[model samples]
Target: MNFIRRLRVPRLNDKGKWVVCVTGGVLTCGFAYALEHTADASDFVVHPFQLPWSHGGLIDSLDMASVRRGYEVYKQVCAACHSMQYIRYRHFVNNFMSEDEAKAEAAESEVDFIDDKGVPAKRPGLLNDFLPSPYPNKKAAEAANNGAEPPDLSLMGWARDDGDNYVFHLLTGYGFDPPEGVLCEEGKAYNPYFPNGSVLAMPQQLFDEGIEYKDGTPATMSQQAKDVVTYLRWACEQWHDKRKQYAIKVYFGNFQFRTPPSFFLTQIMKKWSDFSFFLNYTLLPHGIQSVKKDYLF
Candidate 1:
């Protein structure tokens, strides 16, 4: 008991130092952990009355005609203010449309000239050129609008978890009452999804009066909203298709090698057959399987 007590007591130089250090470290860690947990929880909490449809998955299938019409709306109304700098004219022609059609469209939208150095300046297409900035740059735009610059729409469809629907809602959802004393800015209206119950900086820009459609479709506000939403959804599905195709190819390439080593190939085949049956019975109801063939050829 004497020896144990001697060991338990700290030496004169070390008394209370180790205990203080350990207690401080534990408290600091607990505070840090709590802060991290609070931030994570805040990220997941949906704003009041933000609908699920605002995220993508409302439309059942791709509508090519609607996407084309949406492109027309984007060119006529949105292109002046926003730019899709990353995409090239060649990409549209080679991937989405015929070369001749793309060239004609490009020629209609672009102008060529000579530079001061007498070098030929080829403006092949508006799609190939960056949109001229409304302000000198991002900093100027921010200064003009209380630090809110209009975001690029090109990848907006793919950036958010439910990007397509969120955009659709934003375009249509404007002018709602806020609580007393919570004043909205000029041309801005209350939106539940925005950080505060305030409003977005960009005013509602799309309406039937804004553009004339040659297709004889009603140029209603809802129609324009639906068209732009379709365009964004098409962009999303275009990338999605590439990924799905790659996955199918990889699965097929590895299919033959998954067989077990044995003289009885019958047993190996039987196991695979059972797996297929199980998959069809279980996964088919959930709509998880994308491929039609049970076995890869």
Candidate 2:
């Protein structure tokens, strides 16, 4: 026979629970407010990217056409100022072009490398050569660009606070009339999305039909921004899609073996309560009966 105990659970009154919740909420809000206000304040509005493969999508793969177009746009416009120091011609060969095609593409750009004679010489780029920098060195680049060297675009997609959208906004957020009372510093252009008081060295880069898209896509301002942003995103993490796939597979494969803590706690409570009731009611009752019988005898 199974014996059940009438277990009494102490419950918090509605008012007490409400006070606890309110106190917790107030503390949380205080902490969050402190954290938020601790940083410098600026009117930096982040824009979202118009992408189909963002966050959650069935085919979270890169748009290769956009990538290719972005590369062309970078070559024609951004390459003059910025250098992608991390990227090599082989990256294109492996992902976008064949070896012969990559070689042809590289051959168009002259790169300095050490020849077999151990002397640095200028030669047509090979399939393995890094992208040629627009300036010979940093000092020259800075001198040319008014003491500010243009940053590399290789990781621009991930390096900024807004990730990929930062690049997109910077490319397109130019030409807006500066707000009254806000003076752009000397030699700096006004861009509201720029974190430091809307002052930027780079002027508006993309314009409508600025460059001819070899793929025949219309080169609107927004179109160029999106394509270049896509390429930059790819540059930041070329294997992001593959990494996501691996993560999904690994998570699901091990999900079934994991036990939820709440369920485990409930099971332990049930077993403990059953054993407590049995010890108190069943064992104590028999012991009391035996003591009474022995006294009577």
Candidate 3:
């Protein structure tokens, strides 16, 4: 019943296999040829350190509890300056909060719209209402932050390079004094992990005991940073795990998709006598050349 079952890839012949092999070789060569000869990072900037994220693996899913905690952190802390223009209050339903909680959350916020008289009016937020911005306009945002506007956070995660890792480090990287030869303006602070190690206008936002958690999790600086990063990751891709689940279902549907050595591999019943088509190159065979369980087990 799956769409992948309906996918009808023509049985490949020798000529077709050669074309695929040659095209793959050409693409591989072109990719290697385009490699940049550059340093690991910009001068004065520290490379983002990889953190062990619970949702980072290919098969792993988001930590909903962390996401809930992260929303709390953002509401109490980052929401003061930044705006999540793309996220709606109703997005929380069945994601981390229940429908009732989402409705309650929306009810707490007021939305601006035009009234029947064509006058501006305020109303309680709905599920479709976008999260409110901290400032009325870009100019106001910049003015309040000393001419630097806070960026919208809806696409912050999964949008930047090393997105989640970079954010986690930046939040906890503050409070360290500048190294030798570093200069900061009167109101700026240095964070080696961001802005190319430049002095930025934003100050340390997370601190120990800054806020209490509803779940009674410790309110440490690192804990807050990790939770917020996890939350932002979910905000970036709510259907991330759903996509993985779809792929898994494809293999379980239709006829037997595997051989002795291959798990979930769709092969042409023939063996070394004919070519085998797989994700790319064939790694296992069903006949004499069939791979051992190491290829499946």
Reference-based TM-score of each model: 0.59, 0.71, 0.72
Off by over 4 Å in 3: 1-41, 251-255, 258-297
Q: Could you give candidate 2's per-residue lDDT for residues 1-297 as a string of tens digits?
A: 233456657799999899999999999999999878654345443345554434336447777788889998999999999999888888886676778888899999987678899998988888777888898899999898768889988999878876666777777888877787667777778887777667778888899999999879999998998888888888888886788788788787667455476578989999988866766687667775564345336
Residue range 81-148, candidate 3, lDDT tens digits: 99998899889999999999998988889999999999999999898899888999999999988688
Winner on TM-score between 1 and 2 is 2
For model 1, residues 142-244, the per-residue Cα lDDT tens digits are 7766568776676877776666666766677665566565567775656545553445676667876678776778878878877877776665456554565
- Alpha carbon RMSD to native, model 1: 12.9
Give me candidate 3's TM-score against the actual structure: 0.72
User: Candidate 2 at 1: error in angstroms?
Assistant: 58
Q: Which of the predicted structures, 1 or 3, would earn the higher TM-score when compared with the native?
A: 3
Candidate order, TM-score descending: 3, 2, 1
Q: Which ten residues in a row have the lowest lDDT in candidate 3?
A: 271-280
TM-score of 1: 0.59
Go through the candidates in order and give each one's C-alpha lDDT: 0.64, 0.80, 0.84
- Cα-based lDDT at residue 283, candidate 2: 64
* Off by more than 4 A, model 1: 1-61, 94-96, 110-136, 143-147, 196-198, 235-237, 246-297
